[model samples]
Target: MEPRLDLLSTRAGGDLFTMLVSANNALAASPLPRATQELVKIRASQINGCGFCVDMHTKEAAHAGESPVRLNLIAAWREATVFTGAERAALELVEQGTRLADAAGGVTDEAWADAAEHYDEEQLAALVCQIALINAFNRLSVIVKRPAGSYRPGRYA
Candidate 1:
């Protein structure tokens, strides 16, 4: 599949992609665990059908020492036993957050309370931001039909 546009060369007033990457980097430095961050991105990308993001994040996660079994089971996280309670909560939030129309009244209070139980206010804030950011990137990639599997780990860094 051919990408409709080259996101790298296209400028949106002021190098929009760069600014987006900068924002992503800020999240990277947040108190949120790196593994959790990658898991959130991967889950959101999977739901959004953003192959580019899936490829990017999965590779990054592996590079950072995430287990292959866990990565492979991310889509089936509900039934997977590899994730911790906190990770499960984040994944739950990602699914609800990304599939808002499918979720009844959006993320459930039960899910929110579960996530809040595992994550502190700051971590919750970061998790929310991470979910929103990945969704935005996923939409862009899906809309543009961005080709997948060519991303190198740390390419944006």
Candidate 2:
């Protein structure tokens, strides 16, 4: 399938896309663990039903050495025992943040507090950015009806 538009070819779209990619690259350089970053991206994509992003992040995470078991279990993270407490907290935040419209209070204070217990201020900032960025990507892909399962690791990087 084809994207409705080539986001990278149009001048305005390309500029905005490039800026977003640059922001993502900077976030990748943050102190947040690579595993955590991948997990958050995959989880948010799943929640948002952005198949292109799900395909992209899952492949990228695997290339970064994320295990199949953990990758497969991200959608059911609440019931999985493979994640650390910190990872769990982050997942909680991802769920709440991604489903903001479903919840009355946006991200709950409880979820934020839980994440704070596991991450420093810098790491939390990185996590927030990661969540927001993934959501934006998800919306763009879903709205454009981008097809999935053809992404290669590092293709965008």
Leading candidate by TM-score:
2
lDDT of 1: 0.94
- Candidate 1 residue 133 C-alpha distance from true site, Å: 0.3
Question: What TM-score quantifies how close candidate 1 is to the native fold?
Answer: 0.97
CA shift at 73, candidate 1, in angstroms? 0.3
Q: Positional deviation of 145 in candidate 2, in angstroms? A: 1.1
Taking all chains together, each candidate's TM-score versus the true structure is 0.97, 0.97
Residue-wise C-alpha lDDT for candidate 2, range 86-149, written one tens digit per residue: 9999999999999999999899999999999999999999999999999998898898888998
lDDT of 1 by residue, 1-157 (tens): 9988877776682387777788999999999999999999999999999999999999999999999999999999999999999999999999999999996699999999999999999999999999999999999899889999899998987
* Residue 30, candidate 1: C-alpha displacement in angstroms: 0.5
Candidate 2: which pairs clash?
none
lDDT of each: 0.94, 0.94
Report RMSD (Å) for each prediction in the order shown: 1.1, 0.8
Q: Which stretches of candidate 2 lie over 4 Å from their true place?
A: none
